[model samples]
Target: MATKTRVPQTIDAYLAGVPDPAAKKTLTALRAQLKKLLPKATESISYQMPTFKVDGSAVAGFAFFKHHCGYYPFSGSVVPALAAELDGYVTSKSGVTFPPDQPLPAKLVKKLVQTRLAEIGTRAKKLAAAKKTLITERITDAAVKEATGHDWKAWMRVLDKAGAAGLPHKQLVTLVGRDVESGWWRQSIAVAYEQARGKRVVGETATTGFQVGVVRTLPMTAPQLWTWLTTQPERWLGPGATLNAEVGGSYVAPRRRGNPGVRGEIRVVKPGKRLRMTWQPDGWTKPATLQLTVMPKAKGASLHVHMEKLPDADVREAMRERWSKVLAQAF
Candidate 1:
């Protein structure tokens, strides 16, 4: 009988099998550092890359090609500042690389990978935040005109007439406070309405209410941050939404057929800046608005979120707790 070769179980053994000597050596050094840092990690090949499985999920991976060696922090969203440090190399939205012959920036690589592991600690908190924000935005409602210190009903009528009207972030900031926007009052109203109505609206209708509040600073830039928030329906917002950033465009969040708990949509959008939207609840008179403001800061940017037409006190309190958690993701 012929003897079978034993498959590699350690990163070192895996690297030793690579064809190129230079790539192999660099991978050896990289694997050595990762082993030292993550003693609990198990090495394996996943998606054809050398993956490090921490707990159960593949936390990181690496591979060597002809021109460069690539390192993948699976959920690359963890390290917000890593992008700048990787400026000299060729990079995209996800992975980073270093030339095989050049000395590895071992320290930075370790820091980036290690940070991803740390993020797993807060996954529960992040999910809870997202859920709570979805719930609070739909139930509340207040006199939009009074809370915003503007005759908003009149303003709505104006937009209704214009046929392509959407509120701008700058104009909103002027209305609510130094930090206000067009829909700042809407989130509050939706929350209140939900409390009074005692029903969920997300997956049942054209629009639904949601809870909203300010989000703390995140590690990403204003542009990236906005993209992430508006695009959630595409990722985890259940059946997802039809997103349109155009002025007169419409956003639709269809319900999961026969299921009433999941949905998403874009109620209003003011290109690159302000947005009004609906989330998991489905069906109602109107959806709450999410207004995102980006004020440039020294290190990054200060994000002020204005949620308009939110609901009652109970809804407000619930939403605050929820948003505190959801906002944590940005950092």
Candidate 2:
């Protein structure tokens, strides 16, 4: 009689067939890291891999391959945010790979799990808010004019004259308040101005100061574009481009061929759509903010690069030129 074959049905059973003792050990360690970070999350088999769930949503998963062990956040957002620390490791849009001989660091794994949990919380809040505020009609020029005593174009011109684009959030609000008496109308005007200028959202201010760069329709989807921006920035920015795409994560773009490079921290990351980071170019005393937004177009995607709070006009113009070349190379 032929020997019976073992088929794994659970996480423990799945690990039983890992063959290599070292690989099995690594997988077990990774599992423990996830469990420690997500104490309340339940374990199950998902997509044929060991998965951890919170509130019935798949938060993370891990698998073993012939040469590598993989950790999947189940969302494309986490990989990019942890890009810098993941150097020398294989990574994809939604997962990271470690060699069977080398397991992921406990601290790094903890951070990844924490970041995903925070993202889940943020998305839940946004969904709840979306449900509460349902706008039946589109906001139009006529509506804005009727509500604020000025047409959209007129308000835009007023903002331009006031140099609102370069102003910090608090100052910009004060500037708008000067022209608009009603508090609600002031906020409305602020949002309108920001939108007209292609800014991200209201309450986003330039701490160090504002420069803008733009690259029109490139033949790529938003996710592909995001990969280009975060995965291999050195291809466009400089020789050494290391980016950690999370809030408070660090970035370093070393100078190349006499061109200046930048170093700073990431402030915001909305996967596939937006990324905002501080920009402190080589030799700069104070840092500025850089924001990249990807919008899906008919053919491909449009990328908007905004740098704010530079020291002077010269620095801003120089950065604008550098970014223009960078985008040209990128596309």
Candidate topping lDDT: 2
Q: Please, what are the lDDT tens digits per residue for candidate 1 over residues 59-87?
A: 66777665678776665354345767766
TM-score of 1: 0.38
- Point out where model 1 deviates above 4 Å: 1-13, 76-80, 128-331
Worst ten in a row by lDDT for model 1: 200-209
Q: After superposition, how far is residue 254 of candidate 1 from its true place, in Å?
A: 34
Error in Å for residue 289 of model 2: 40
Model 2, span 79-197: residue lDDT tens:
78888988888775567877888888888888888887887788678656643432212367787777777777787788898789876556777898876788877776775566556
TM-score per candidate: 0.38, 0.41
